[model samples]
Target: MQSTATSIKAYLEEIPEERKIAFTKLRETILENIPKGFVEQMSYGMIGYVVPHSIYPDGYHCEPKLPLPFMGIASQKNFIALYHMGIYANPELLNWFVTEYPKHSTQKLDMGKSCIRFKKMNQIPFELIAALVQKMSVQEWIICYESAFKK
Candidate 1:
């Protein structure tokens, strides 16, 4: 569910009580491992990590006013979702994540083009998520974003 909360703190507060711990840990994992240069903010009604306008003045191609989004996390209706643009734009990263998922969790990966759904909070692989977050830097993301989405 898209949250109407304007800040990350408020967003977290709005999530179901049972999910708060896991979701907060997931958020912490991303914050700790994400390479330098990405800024944390609320974007698309979720907790978003983005290359700010200071770094990428061109902004998101789809919406130039918005920063270039790198990753996002949200507590959805039935699951918590982690959205990584790197995995969607970089096949190598996607493959790596796919290959390593089984080693981390027994749960079959429930994923979309860029969104990884954690239906079981206990199964959310914080370590795997940490590794994934560190796989790309802001500069690398800008390059990948331009190549994959910019016309």
Candidate 2:
């Protein structure tokens, strides 16, 4: 499949008809809550958001390379994946998620560095997810994301 960088508007347009509504709504909510300088794009065959290095310069290990992706969203084979930096990155928020979300379950989620997989959208506690996304800073997210994947 052909893939390229795109905006959220473009990414939403490309989602298959059956999944468009739900995914678009989710994308909107994320955009509404995430911090300024966060961007949406298609990466790894999914809709993803990134906090570019220009926005979080102190957090970058190298300039003009490896700008971090603090959060991401993906439509997978069976379910939609909301890859938050919170899963393994922020223990406090992750603990809350584990306890608060009704049908959510998490194991060793390490896809491109610490992604939590959710089978059903409703199973997520939207308020908490938004809160976590908003509360965690880009540097915090980078720390958590990298720590999770450390070898």
Q: Output the number of the lDDT-best candidate.
A: 1
Runs in model 1 lying further than 4 Å from the true structure? none
In model 2, which regions exceed 4 Å deviation? 1-10, 57-64, 103-113, 121-124, 143-151
TM-score of 1: 0.99
* Residue 39 miss distance in model 2 (angstroms): 2.5
Worst 10 residues of 2 by lDDT: 104-113
> Least lDDT summed over 10 consecutive residues: which range in candidate 1?
1-10
Tens-digit lDDT string for candidate 2 (55-139): 7554434433645666777766666667776665667877766665554323332233356555555444456566656877665
lDDT of 1: 0.96
lDDT of 1 by residue, 46-66 (tens): 999999999999999999999
Evaluate all candidate structures by whole-model CA lDDT and list the values in order: 0.96, 0.62
All candidates: TM-score:
0.99, 0.69
